[model samples]
Target: MGQSSSARHRRNLTRPSQISSSMMDGSSKGTDLVQEDGVIEGHDYISSIPDDVLSSIFNNLSTSDRKISAVVCKRWLIVEGQGRNRLVLNARQELLPIIPTIFTRFDSVTKLVLRCDRRSVSIDDESLIQISLRCQNLSRLKLRGCRELTDVGLAAFSKNTKYLKKFSTGSCLFGVKGMNAVLENCKYLEELSIKRHHGVLEPVSPDFIASDSLKTICFREIYNGHCFGPLIIGAKNLKRLKILRCMGDWDRIFQTMSTRKDNPIMEIVLERIQLTDAGLESISRYTNLETLHLVKTPECTDMGLISVAENCKKLRKLHIDGWRMNRIGNHDGLVNIANHCSNLQELVLISVNPSSESLEELATKCKTLERLALCGIETMGDIEISCIAEKCVELKKICIKGCPITDKGVEAFAWGCPNLVKIKVKKCRDVSGKVIDKLKARRMNLVVSMDSIQIEPESVVDDGGDGGDGGESEPTASSSSSNGGSGSGSVFNTRFGLLAFTFRRWSIGGGGRSV
Candidate 1:
C-alpha cells in the first residue's frame, strides 16, 4: 500500500513476464477467450461513408437488391427512402403497418404502383389520402385491385396532387363519381387508363367543364363504358382512345363526337366491343386519324372501310382482326382502305384472307408501307407472301404467324424484299431448320432466325406474331456483347448496369455525388 514510484514501475514491468504461456503463445485452442453472445464484430464502414456516395452505390443495385440494402442499417434505409423516385408497394395488408414510415422516407417518389390484395382488406380512402399527401410530385400512379378506394379518396388525390399527368386504376370499385373527381381536378392530366372498374354502368351525363389537356383515354373490361359521350365531348384535344370489352351504344357516342367541329381524335382502338358498321361510319368523320385498331368487331364490313376511306386520308397505321378467309379476300374492306389510305405504313391483319388482287393493290398503292403482319390466316399461302415481297418496295419487317407457306413462298419473300431487315415467323409447319439456318447464314448482316427451334413440319402455335417492335426475343449471353447493327430493326440488349449508372448519374447530378 505504501509502495514508492520505482516499486510500482518495477511491478508493471514484471506483469508481461508473469503472463500465462497458453494465452501468450496460443498453444491451447480451448484457452482462447470467446464471445458467447453470437454477435458480429465489425466497423460500420458503409454507414460511415457520405450519404451521396452511399446513394450512388445503392442505385447500381436492382429494385430487390435495394430493398435488401435498406435493412442493412438505419443510414442505408434513410438513403434508400430519400433517393427513391419509382416505388412499387404490393401486399397492402402486410405493408400497412410500415406504410407511414415508407411515405416519410420516399418523399422524392414520382412514380408509384399500389396493388392491393382483394382477398384481404383493400386499400381504403385513408391509404390513398396518405399517398396523395406524401407524394405530391407523383406524375404516374397505378391503383390495382383496390376495391375499397372511393370517390372521396380520388377527390383528395386531385385536390392535393395537381401534378398528376398519367393515372391508371384496375379492378377497383369506384364509379363515375371517382372518374369525375379526377377529370375535374387534374388540370394537367394527359392520359387515363381504367380497367375492370365499376360504377360507370349507366350513361354519365356531361357537366359544364371540359378537360382541355386530355390526350389519351383507355377503358378495358369496364361494363357499360360505351356510353362515354360526356367524357369524349369534354376532352376536345383527345387524340388516342382505346376501348376493350365494354358494353353500351359506342356507335351513338362516335356519331355524337363526329358532330363536334373541333374533334382531333387521331388513334382509336376498339377490341371485343359491339361496334358495328354504323359506329365505323361515325369514325370516318375524323379525317386526321392516323392509327386505328379494330379487333373482334364482326359488325364492321366493306361499307365501314368505304366510309372511313372517304375522310381518313391521314391514316398511317391500321390493324384489323376477326376476318374469315372467305369474307376478307372477297373484294371486302381491305380493297377500300388499300385504295384510299395511300400513306399507310404499318398493317396488321388477324384471321384475314386478303385477296391476291387486294394484296397486289396494297403493294402498289401503299408504296410507303414498311411493316406488315399476317396472323392466324391459315389460307395465306406462297402467292400472297411473294406478292407482298415484290410489291412493298420499302417493306422493312414482316411477321408471319399461323400461315401454311412452304419453301417457295419464304425464299421468294426473302429474295424480293431487299429492304427487309428482320423476319419473324411462327407456326409455319413447312419451314425446315435447314431453311432457317441458310437464311441466317445468308443474311448475317440482318436478323434472320426462327424462335422455338424445330426441324419437323408439324409445330405448335406459340402465339400470334407481335407485329410491332418485330417480336422481341429473349437476349442470349453471346448476343449481349454485340451492338444493334446499322439496320433499323436489329434488336440488341443494352447493358443494364451501364444504363442504371447513367440514369443514377443524370438524376443525382454532379453536386449530389460530392455529398
Candidate 2:
C-alpha cells in the first residue's frame, strides 16, 4: 500500500509536464490541480495578496520599479498609485494633459522633480499650479528648464507646497520677485538653490527672507547677488554656503557675510567668483569652520590663507586652486596652515606652488593627513614628491594632474607611504607607462589610475583647466566620473568636455547640492 501511494505522488507531480505535448498540439484541454475529493484549485499567484500588504510592498519601490510592480494585476495598479510618494515626471508639453491624472494617482508624493528637455516644450504656469495643488504634501521640489513659469504660477505653487523643505530651480525665466515669492510662500523651507534667476527691476523685498530657516544655500551664475545681501546676512544658523560664478563685487559681499558674530559656518566653497585677500580675511571669525575650498579665485594671495589657518584650527580639509594666476606661492600660508590646522586630513593644491618646505611641514605636523592631491604646480617635482612619500604615513589616496613629476617622483610611492592604496595621474607630460608599471609591480595591491588628457599646462604652474573639481560642497562637480568624463576637455583638447562637465556640475539647482 505504501509503494502504491508513493507511485501516485510521483505521477501527480509528473502529470503537468506530461500534458505539455498535447497543449503544444493545440489541444482544448485545460490543466488544473485536483485533489482526491475531485475539487479543482486554480493558482491564484501574487494576486491573492491583500491590497494593504501589496501597498506596503509597493511603497518601498522606486517610481519606475513600481510601474512594473503595478502590472501584476488590476488591484496592484491601484495599490501602487496610492502608495507612491516620490516621482520624477517628464514635463514635455504633450504630457501636460495627463499630468493631472498622474498626480491624482500618486497623490501622496512628497518629493518631486519636473524635468523638461531643452528642445522640448515644457509645462507652463497652469500645469505647474495644477501639479502643486494636487501634490500639496510635497517636501522637496525641483524644476529644471521650465521657463514659462512666471511670478503668478510660482506664488500659487509655493502656497500649495507649504511643507516644502528643499527647493531647487535652474534656467527658469524669472526675476528676483518670482524667486522671493517662493521664499515668501514656502515658510517651511530649509534648503534653497537658484541658478540664472534674474530680471530687470527686481522689486527689493527683504521682509520675507527665508534665511532664518535655511541651512544651505547655493547660487551659481547669478548676475545680481547684491540684491540678496540682506537675505544672506539674516541667516543666523547657516551651515554650508557655496557661491560660484556669481558676477559682482563678491569680495565685499563675502567679507561682510563672514563678519557675522557667533558664526556656526563650517564648510565654505568659493569658486570662479571675484574673491580677493580682503574678502577671505573675515573667514577667520568662523572658529568652527572645518572645510574650506578656494577655487579659481586668482586675487586671493598668501594673506588670505594665513588668516584662515590662524583661526580655523578645527579645519579637516583644505582645497586651493590658484587658477591661471601664480601669486599664491612663496609665502608662509601653507606653513602656517601646517602649524595651526593640526587636524587637517585632506589637502588639494592646484597651481598653488608649494615648496619643499611647506609640503614637508604638512607631512610632519599634519599626522592625520590621509589624502593629498597636487596638480600643475611647477614647483612640485621629484624632491617634493619624495618628501610626501617619506612622511605622510597616513596617506591613502594621492591624485596628481599636470604636475612636472617624472619617473622618479611617480615611482617613489612604491617604497614609501606604507598605507597608500590608490594613485591617480592626469595630464602630466613626464609620467610614463613604464614607470607606472614598475611602481605597480612593487605595490601589488595598490590602485594606480592614469588618464591621457595631456593638455599642456600654461603659466609654469597652471593645472591646464579647472576640470570642475569643487571638492567639498560641490559634490556633483567633484565626482570621479565628472573628472574622467568632462570639464578638462577631451584628449584632443576641445572645450566640449569642460562645457559638458560645467552644465552638470555648476548648474545651480543640481550643483552645490550638499544641504
**What TM value does model 1 have?**
0.76
Cα displacement (Å) at residue 369, model 2 = 1.1
Per-residue lDDT of 1-515 in model 2, one digit per residue for the tens?
55788667744553554357547867544365544544435645566778788888877776678778788777777788787766778887776689878977777888788888889888888898888888888888888888777888888888887888888888778666677777777777778777766552453465655646788778778777556666676677888888878776776666777767778888887878877888878887788898888878888888888988898989987878776476664448889999999998778787677778988998999998877877667788899898899898988778777677787898889999999766777666666667766876777667666664222223222222333222113223222332335443332232112222322221222222221
Best by TM-score: 2
Q: Give the lowest summed-lDDT range of ten residues in model 2.
A: 506-515
lDDT of 1 by residue, 253-356 (tens): 88888988857999898987888788888899997898888776777776787788777999987777754524332356778878889998788777667677
- Show pairs that collide, candidate 1: none
Q: How many residue pairs clash in each candidate?
A: 0, 2
Candidate 1 Cα errors over 4 Å, as ranges? 1-57, 71-74, 91-96, 323-330, 454-515
Model 1 lDDT, full chain set: 0.70
**Candidate 2 runs further than 4 Å off:** 1-8, 11-42, 49-69, 93-96, 200-204, 440-442, 452-515
